[model samples]
Target: MRLIAPFLLLAALPAFAADPTPEITRPAGTPQANGVVHTLRQIPEACARIEGAFTGQAAEPYRFAVVRTSQNCQPRARFVDFDKAKPSEAAGWKFNDLIRVPSAACPSQQAVVRVWRKPVDVGQERDGQGQSRIYLDDAMKTAAAGKLPAIPMYAAAMSVEGKACP
Candidate 1:
């Protein structure tokens, strides 16, 4: 009876277990790298991704740019809103507040720069040891192919002055 009770308890435990977190699947054409790509809050209607490269330099370690997921799909939102008033540092990178940048698609609306850093090394040691090297190499290939290196960080859009969509 003792052994049977233990088995029954174990079986019931799973029924009461908490639900697992949903897995976020990366969109097609997401840049592959050794380091982890932190998930960003996304605009439900808009599709976007973080595009940039690892310079592998001290003066300018990381360069990030937000772009649309597809050229044909024009989202109403222009810029990403991190909901931050000031820059925050994490994992050797400085996540900046919303900074407007010129947008070719929407001339009146400015795009936002969610992150930027000029850290020396950007703590390569912390990036999965030797992963940064692999990223640099992959970045070069992406650039050569006439495509900017990109990750799966989808930016949450912020509507600016003007009609949201053309």
Candidate 2:
């Protein structure tokens, strides 16, 4: 009876612990059929899709410049610098690999690209009225899967800052 009681207590302890949230996978820089390299950006209230072209070699330590392709997008989130440094587990964001993107201005049709993501905070996930706020991580996954357009308009929007191709 003593051994059984201890096992039951251990099983119940898991219920009191918070469920672990899934981590978002790093985004890739693969371009879509329309020649647009789609990626995600963390906005104030939601995750946004940003289109851009790679500007250098398709290797580590690349740079991605934001381009203005859509009318419905956030304008402030611009520029991503991907470095070769190791990603820090303690930091909210980490460095990811470089990818090839289509670029017109660049000598080569392809350009180098890298991605960085910021960790989502628990408090920011909910609003004062207890309503859910951001869906950045989910949008990021969708973008990586090459299905950014399928996401609901409210959950994600288009974002652009400058012209990466021109």
- Flag clash pairs in model 2: 73-158
Give the local distance difference test score of model 2: 0.40
Per-residue alpha-carbon lDDT of candidate 1 for residues 1-166, written as tens digits (9 for 90 to 100): 8789989999888854622222332222232232333233343235656544433333433345455677787654344345542223443334323333333343443333334321343333435554655467876997999975333222232322233323
Residue 141, candidate 2: Cα error in Å is 33
TM-score of every prediction relative to native = 0.25, 0.28
User: Model 2: per-residue lDDT, tens digit, 67-132?
Assistant: 444566544343333343323435545333333444444423444333444434443356789897
RMSD of each: 20.9, 18.6
Candidate 1 lDDT trough over 10 residues, lowest sum:
19-28
lDDT of each: 0.41, 0.40
Residue 82 lDDT, candidate 1, scale 0-100: 50
Question: In model 2, what lDDT does residue 82 have?
Answer: 31
